[model samples]
Target: MTSDADPRFLRSREAILNAARELLLESGPTAVTHVQVAERAGVGRATVYRHWPQAEPLLVEAMATVPMPFLDKPTVPTREWLRRELTAIARQLDLDDVRAVSTTLANTALWDEDMDARRAQFAGILTTRLAAALDDAQARGEITLALASQDAAAMTIGPMYYRSTIERAPADPALIDAAVNALGTWAAG
Candidate 1:
């Protein structure tokens, strides 16, 4: 009978993922080699490779484990929920691990078929969530004017990305509030 305490059970896929996440946070994607991950995880290089043959997929999986922000549709109204949700997203964007993942995605030179597919999947997740939030807000009469959910989402998230990547500045609560207010004004106009 196989014991649950076997070494295989001890070093599960999650252990590998955690080790990879740490490496990505510390040294970026380029440093996430199989040997390096094995050293960090205290596992053999062969074991790491056996679990994840390529580095990009492994990194992508590690990144996916990082929680993406989502706004819960509230029975009250969309505007209130959006304000809360955008604030949360802004706060999450300030996290070092989140910034590291964004930086890694921007710098990855592997633009092959697999990477393209993965990028599309990642984008879809963001797009869908943003759309839902905007729709909920519209339904609640929070946004008075006609604006596409996609555009609103872009406007809301773009500044956060700019501050995180281009400016290399931490996201401030005041800044997020300002963005939300601006969006609300535009909608009301």
Candidate 2:
């Protein structure tokens, strides 16, 4: 039987994926070529090719493995929940792989359909969680729903992104706290 049917095949595939993920997380998509993944996984290039026809699939898989942040409907006070979400943003920004690739993804949407799709998916997740928090705030008479929930959500995340991408700074807890306070004050108005 081909390796696909064997239990060992799963191990091999896992090794390949882990190797690709490590490289992608260290550098970016450009570092995750078939030859490199095969070398890192101790597999043959042809084997890598057989499993994944192109680098893009491997890149996608590797990126998919990176844990995206999720915040449930919170039980804590609004400010605390906002702090948690802001902290999540700060943590995500600390990922070298994400920072390396975000600029290209942000600017090259027309040419990079793959990245564009990824961005859309990420943004959708972000908007959903943010909107939920805003909904809670509105219910509590905390915020003006004068703007679209998504737009307000953008306002919440935009500063964190600015610090991550433009300011070239690390995730500071104090900064997250400040952001949370600003968001809370705005919502309270």
Candidate 3:
């Protein structure tokens, strides 16, 4: 067994992960088997299986490497922030790769405990960012949320996911505008 501190081990791991990610983007999650990843990584099948015993966790980890749209920019007014957040979500969901990976994550997570935990962790990060924005707005006295920021985030984000992934339709400008307007009304009320 190679030590984790070994440079070769790290390089091999990185290569395997990158290969898995490429497979996911090129052919979707169904293509990300141990043999396929090993072949793509130029490593042995044992190496891939040794590192990730299950295909689901490996796929989830690869998807985690994806760069998600974030609310990391400078803070803006609440309304502006909400609009920008929704717009970002719509744009990300519009991507074929993101949609495919997202659907895979949602589906595999149902049967894999590790994947489910990873999925929850990913979702928590997004929800926390959104909640922070809502909390900031409340602090500024811009809007009063009738529900918690987490709940507000669900209201704002759930529809975009549904429209893009479930409906297999673009998250149109009208939908974004309506989500923004509806959230504003709910918060104001």
Best by lDDT: 3
Worst 10 residues of 2 by lDDT: 180-189
Off by over 4 Å in 3: 1-11, 18-59, 63-68, 185-189
Please, what are the lDDT tens digits per residue for candidate 1 over residues 14-46? 678889888877775566678888888888787
Candidate 1 Cα lDDT to native:
0.68
Candidate 2 per-residue lDDT over residues 1-189, each given as its tens digit? 466777777878899999999997786567888889999999999888878775665666687687554555665466677777778766666665456556556775557687678878767777887777777887887755666666755776777788889987876887776655554344433
Which 10 consecutive residues of model 3 have the lowest summed lDDT?
180-189
Clashing residue pairs in candidate 3 are none
Candidate 1: regions farther than 4 A off: 1-42, 45-57, 65-69, 72-75, 185-189
Taking all chains together, each candidate's TM-score versus the true structure is 0.63, 0.62, 0.69
**lDDT scores for all predictions?**
0.68, 0.72, 0.78
Stretches off by above 4 angstroms in model 2 are 1-42, 45-60, 65-67, 142-146, 184-189
| TM-score of predicted structure 2 | 0.62
Clash totals in order = 0, 0, 0
RMSD of 2: 6.2
lDDT tens per residue, model 3, 30-69: 7788999999999999999878886766777887886544
Which residue window of length 10 is worst by lDDT in model 1?
67-76
Model number with the top TM-score: 3
